[model samples]
Target chain A: MILAYIGLGNMGYIIAGHIADKLKQDGEPTLLVYNRSNAKVDALIADGKHVQSASIDHIARHADIIFTCMFNDEASKQIIGKDMIGSGQMKHGAIIVEQATIRPDTAEFLASIANEKGLHYLTCPVMGAPPRATAKLLVPLLAGNPAQRKIVRPYLENVIGKVVVEVGDSPGSALRLKLCGNYIIVTMVEMIAEALTLGEASGVGQNKVQELLAGLFAGTPVTDYAQRMTDETYDDVRFSLDGANKDTTYILDLAEKSNADIPMAKVFKNHLDKLTSDYPSLDISGVVGVVREASGLPFNLKKA
Target chain B: MILAYIGLGNMGYIIAGHIADKLKQDGEPTLLVYNRSNAKVDALIADGKHVQSASIDHIARHADIIFTCMFNDEASKQIIGKDMIGSGQMKHGAIIVEQATIRPDTAEFLASIANEKGLHYLTCPVMGAPPRATAKLLVPLLAGNPAQRKIVRPYLENVIGKVVVEVGDSPGSALRLKLCGNYIIVTMVEMIAEALTLGEASGVGQNKVQELLAGLFAGTPVTDYAQRMTDETYDDVRFSLDGANKDTTYILDLAEKSNADIPMAKVFKNHLDKLTSDYPSLDISGVVGVVREASGLPFNLKKA
Candidate 1:
């Protein structure tokens, strides 16, 4: 069996590299790679991995299983339809697993189309950033038919992530999960920023509050993010604020659709939206900057 | 020296207790106390600690130093004016320290009146809840006459809190600090709540996100609060949502006075306001319940 992987952004690139390493070690399936950017594909190829196709159609035709890791739903649909499905590159009963963060409705629509073509489509978005992906510590949330999951089990067992949580058989379950996860991150950022500002105002010192919180509850991403806010350190953008804000907006839209009262999320979204203006060039952690500005305090003071 | 303490609420009671304990051990200053309910004072009196006065005036007439830890600015002003200043119970140059969380302007006004009476006054509001106060781990943000601070240094150093940060000479400085610190907590509650909902929606599991954030940044309050949110375990209120909302509103008011853009704080206040309606009796951590509601999920569901 051969696995076809498309897209080579930060997440996609790292995931594809892991797959190649897994194939070489496991010897159960070969790795086939294709990226819209030929340089990225060539770069991966130079690492001595198999290059199955320069185009999406070639990847679909040559590999039994296809995995997509892209920016959003639109990109995923474009590559899969224009280059793979529309070109009749996929064989009967071929499986497609998506790892991008996308809207639930889009994933379901794509899945239905795949079903008509006798293709098995699974939504399998991932958790963790680029660093975790490189370290094989990413978490994968998969949703699809039992048989399709079984067919890809060998390839997915260790290649992509540390844990694979099966959300459901619905195609959009994975996407929903991913979107939800992003929502949590933005909320964390917003709170960290506000807390840090408050701590400084109280004369407790931001560093002390950061230390106290981290010590009390040391096993949370929000705490790690809190430290960053307290220190005003936002250089290493594992997740950009703009991305977070966008995800939060999407969640808000979801909440609106359901007519659910999400005052907390709505508040968080407002923070992120304002953050774009406060620290125009800073990372998402810059939300803290807005807090400081509002309290008549400097976000970060220069050491005298 | 004799120290008279007032206001035996959650935080006040612990602080007064600590001072009494210290005075007992040192065998220097005598401890006097008063409260509206008087039960806690009666208990302390029963424990052989010095107790005095049906009103603040009695303490002011008898004690060398008068310390108060009331609910807000109005209460602090009322206790000082009706029982001490207006009653002519204060001794010339006797030091009075206010430890309530009040508006900065109120603190300044109270300080001015104390100054007119030839009494030394210090605005010395503290950080930390009842638990921290009980442990004598609270941080005090103090502002007032340097001479008065020096006079009370021995006792304040011995019992009240762990650290005393000198914010400014202005009467309102300490109150400002307190407001700023609480702004942080309220901001954190809003952010963490939103994140919990998002994480649940994404299938990452709220507990998982909490765990990840805590481990990564274990010293942040964000993690501690986020963990409470993830577990939905906030029965015993360390801090109530109503109280937190009040503080946030106060902070926003201060922000308005400074002409500061505290949009994040406004968002936090709004969330807390809404949370009061949904989880009327739930603790501040129950803000996460609002998030879960937005996600179309139960507020207290365990991961399968």
Candidate 2:
């Protein structure tokens, strides 16, 4: 059986690299890899664990099990389109594991097309940043047929994820879960920004605000983001505003299509849009600066 | 120095009982206690530790340091009003530590009146619920004169709080910080509710959603509330919709007063308002039901 990994962005690179390393350590054949950019592919190849595939079609035809971690729907759609699945590139019964934050409808469409060609498709979008993926601490939200899930569970558990949650049999379910998770995370950033802004505006010292948040929020994402907000470390962007904007847009679109009223997501999207327009390169945490500025406080809490 | 504890509600009862027990253990003079309802006062008295004050005025006159943990602005205002602080009921140089969640403006007004009467007032609104207060695990956000802060620091540290954060010299700063903390918490509930609704609507089991949240949110308020949301335990009402609604309103008011654009808080306030109007008796976590309903999912995710 051959294994292939696609996409080489921050998160995708770390996760795919980890899978390849694990497969190599187990004395399996060299893993197959591909990316839109040759630089990431070259970087991975230089590390000496995998063979680079000539193209998406090459991996689709050659690999028994392929994992795709594209940045968004468009990237995934372009690479995993009819040409890859419908054109007889993928052998019948080969499994496709998708691990991107995409809309449920998109996942469903992809699943329908892949199923038509007798190719098994699983939506397994993951949670955590590149660092977590590198540490093999990322959690996968998995949704697929029971047999396909059983086939991929070993790699997801041993090679990449700390926890793999089987959401359901529907392909869209995993994507929806991922979008919902992102919605929570993005909303958390907004809440932290607003809270820190309120604290700074009220003449509470940044250290004290951090202390209170550390005490109250304890082990949550809010505490992690609170440190970033207090330190004004947006320049070291792990997740850019542009990426967050894409996720937020996807979430809002999903909510609209589902007729779910996620007003907090809407509010966050607007705040993010305004902030990203002025400082498009800022990290997702830079929303704190927008919050602080709106409250008439200085941009950086540390400086303030 | 004489010490008094007032307002024996769910949180106030346990916190005052703890303070009184600690003081008794130290062999200090009797701790003075008061509550609007005679039952809680009687319950504490029956626990065989402290003496009950005849009235708020009596505690004001007798205690050198008075700790009030009233429920809201109106309740606190009534007890610490002109008849109490303004009428020279509190002895000169006595200290009043306000631990209730109240508006910063109300705190400032109370401080002004107390100061005029040669009394020191400290806004020391705390984080954590009744159990935390009972365990002396509550974290206090304190703001007052430095000398007064020094005087109360020991009691706040040893008798009640696990950690004490001194925000600033302004009396209302602590209250503002507390409100900000609450805003983050309330907004967290909304985000959790929205995410869970999305998960359920997309056919993700509540257990899987809870697992993902537990892995993602970890030791945060989100995890605790996620458990509550999935169990449909909002009816247990440790923190009621009424209480959350009050805090959200205070946050929105503070934001408006500060000219801060807390759009997330505004969205939360609107959501809470709608939810409370329909299910006034629901726990704060009941906001999840509202979110689920909005998404056309069942009100109880567990049932769904």
Candidate 3:
């Protein structure tokens, strides 16, 4: 049996590396790694494990299971449309695990297309940043057929993530869950940014409020984001403002369709819009800068 | 020296009880407890430690250090304005610890009035609800003159809280920090509500999202709120809607004055407005009801 991981970006690279390193030790499935850039592909197989660089065509035809962490719907479509599903090249009963956070319609369309071609497609978008990915502590939301879920269970659980939340067998359940989860994260960033700004504006400084948060909200992602906001430590860029805004957009769209009122998310998205347009490369924590600037304060509160 | 605790409400009762219990053990100051309702005062002294039930006037005239947790500024003004400070019956060099979350102007004005009367008015607001208070684990934000802070330090730490976060030596600094901290909480409730509603709308169930939250934010108040949101456990009413809205009001007021742009806070306040209107007696977690209604789901998702 063979496994293929297509897309080696920040998260995908770390996740795929773990999969390759562990699967090589198990000595069962040879991992076929593919990336749009040749350098990333080279980096994946640099350790010379059970991993091998494979072309998209070879992955589509030969790989029994393919994991995709794509940039967006367009990128996923470009690769899976022409080379895999449309080309009629994928093996029968081959499973495709989508680890990308895509729109509900895109996810359902892909799932239905794969079903029509005698393939199983599962929406299994993950939650957590690159650090969580590196630690294999990410939470992967899995939604697909029971049989297909069973096939991919071993690879995802202890191999890559701390736990796998099985959303449902429905086509878009996992994708919707992904949007909901991302909604929580982006809104948390918004909340932390506002609190930090309020602290700074009140002459309490961000550090004291951060100390209070440590006492109250320690052992959470809130602390990590709060630390970044307090001292202008956003250059690490664990999650880009563009990606964060995209999820916010997806969350808003879901709210529109599902008839949910998430006004706070809209505001959070607006902040993300300003942040994304300005810094582009800064992490999501840069939302604090927008908040600080509004409070008649410096963008970065770090002391000279 | 005599120690007085002037409002035996939910939080004050627990906090004063702990302080009285520990003070009795140390054989230091005797605690004079007062409350609006006599039954609450009765319950407090029922343990028969170093606690003594006293009239507000007696607490005003003889107490060296006073801690007050009033219902509102109006109530605080009633007790401290006429009965304590305005009466001119209290001793010189007395300290008034304003544990209530009052308006910023109210805090500063109270501080000024107390200063004019030769009293130490410390804006020391405690963080956490009744449970944390009962556990002697509340975090008190102390902002006042250094010597006064030194006097009140022992009563707050270990006796009623885990530790004290000294916000500043400026008037209203503790109050502002309180607003910022509560902003994080209210916005967290908003974030959790929206996330839970989206989960229910997508048929993923609030429990799954709550499980995800436990993994990501277990040690924070977010988990407790997520549990309440998931099961519609707002009936317990840890913090009432009316009170939560009041703090949100103070936060928005501060944001407006500080020139900070907290659009998400505006959205949160709006949802809270709807919440305060509908379930006036429910906990702040009922914000989930508003989100669920918008998502076309029922208010209570708890299984029958």
Candidate 4:
């Protein structure tokens, strides 16, 4: 009945916290947590909930259900391959849940590997930043075996996120859908940036754009990014520009491999490449600053 | 207090109907309505509400607050200049409300002419399609004299639309903001098209994308358009590709004048050009079909 959580990045950290809290509330087995960095592990321990620090070997061998949210495909692959699967580390019939956004082919390959080892693997990549994870506003995409899906469904919805989008059987499907979601988000930022900048440039003011966005696109990411675009509050770095730029790489790669025509995504990637180089420390919404600069305006929209 | 409404296009017809209803409810003057063609006027008269068709000269001379929603600048100018502003056709200190999506300069010029002749001109461009107008979901952008805005604000909100974004004093300001709002919508279509096409091309399917869009953009136009994309419903055009393509002209014109570098809008324009050439009868959301065709797939997402 033991559950294990891995990766302690911003999104992973907040999500793992929710899972531990829910399990502890239900009086389930202690949640085994593992990360290369111990600070997050120590922070989870200090919270003194259901989470306990565990080494990779310990988590894989003991935990009945393991969740991984690593940085990239290669990192997630190594841990699932050399460290866990068929290495006498994980219990038989144990479930491995992947939340990291990796290439569809890579995810498919890993799912096959785990299946061959008498293990169940599922991809459940989520939509939204860490703040959304904290607020339980994230949308998790679930794809894999129906049985494994049923087992982990309790831990996702109303726990770490508000809803779940069942992406169906292929593990690649969830990851590909995750890329499509990211495609919507990043291109949405570009759309917001352009609209706000156009407003400012045309002397209509971003304030009016803000008003229109509130009325037209309320409860969506467009409103969320429009506020940031109008407010000039990018230094907080909730999701770093570097990470957003990295996502464009995967989105473009998926489009390239599939021969999908996503010119909007290409435009976003061009903006991301420029913005990530210029302001790596700002939040991903900093693409607005690039749009402002291209319009020959100052980086900040706030009037002095 | 005579009230006049000119033009009975799909949007204007529904809006004029609402205004006539509101005035009837309040026991005010019967609305003075005028249009070149009398079919819509016949239709309105047949409804047996508080509306009666009148000549342009009669409306100009008698109506205290006149609302005009014409097709283009030239037509609006001919009516405003030759039929309304002066030459003993209109009363002094009257107010003219223009709700057409005309050029910024044309609105400004109309405002200037109306002001010089002791008449008030206000631009009240609205967002949303004719269906939205029917549902009272339209967002109107108002810009003009503050006192004049005060005169018309009551008739706008809760009558034809839910809210009005008061865009500054310059009449052109509202038009500019309207273009910006259009920019957000059309670019949003491009983003949705690219994301759904990417999903289908990658073999993830638009159903998964539809589920994700529902969760991520629940209350926005993205959800509205995503449903159409996933369902392959394009022939029942709510916002025709021709009309959508015309809007891109104003949007690009504004961006060109303002020197705003909106690559997303440019991409949208390119797609609109292609989509309109191919599917003029389809809805503007039919841009998804172009994305699919470019990806070597069928125009529709529904399975055979």
Query: How much does each candidate deviate at the interface, measured as C-alpha RMSD after superposition?
Result: 4.8, 1.7, 1.4, 0.8
lDDT of 3 by residue, A252-295 (tens): 88878878777778888777888888889999898899878777
lDDT of 1 by residue, A1-304 (tens): 7787888888888788878787778665557777767888888878877444445656778778888887776887887755677677688888888888777878888888888888888988787777667777777878889888877765665776655777778877666666656665665566566656655655545665565455344566656678667666776676776567657767777556545454656656666677776655567777777677667787674321
**Deviation (Å) of B127 in candidate 4:** 1.5
DockQ of predictions, in order shown? 0.22, 0.60, 0.71, 0.88
In Å, residue A182's CA in model 1 sits off its true spot by 2.8
Chain B TM-score, candidates in order: 0.92, 0.95, 0.96, 0.95
Those runs of model 2 whose alpha carbons end farther than 4 Å from true positions after fitting are A48-57, A87-89, A205-207, A297-304, B50-58, B87-89, B205-207, B297-304
Candidate that scores best on lDDT: 4
**Each candidate's fnat, in order?**
0.35, 0.64, 0.78, 0.90
Clashing pairs in 4: A61-A89
* Candidate number that wins on TM-score, 2 or 3: 3
TM-scores of chain A across the candidates, in order, are: 0.91, 0.95, 0.96, 0.96
* Maximum-TM-score candidate: 4
Q: What is the C-alpha lDDT of each candidate?
A: 0.71, 0.81, 0.84, 0.87
Worst 10 residues of 2 chain A by lDDT: A200-209
lDDT of 3 by residue, B1-304 (tens): 8899988888888888898988888887779988888887888767675788888889888999999999898987778876789988888999999999998678788888888999989988888878788878899999889999999898888888878888888868888889988887888888888888877776677777788888888767888888877767888888888788788888999888887777778878888888888888889888898888877887776644
Steric clash pairs (candidate 3)? none
Over 4 Å off, model 3: A302-304, B302-304
Q: For candidate 1, what is the DockQ-based docking class?
A: incorrect
Supply the DockQ value of model 2: 0.60
Per-residue CA lDDT of model 1 for B1-304, tens digit only, reads: 8788888888877777778777778776567788989788887777776455446667878778888888776788788856687677678888888888877778778888888888877987777667667667677777799888877766666476656667668777667766766766676666566655655555545565564444344465666778677666777687887677668778888766665554567766666677888777778887776656656787677643
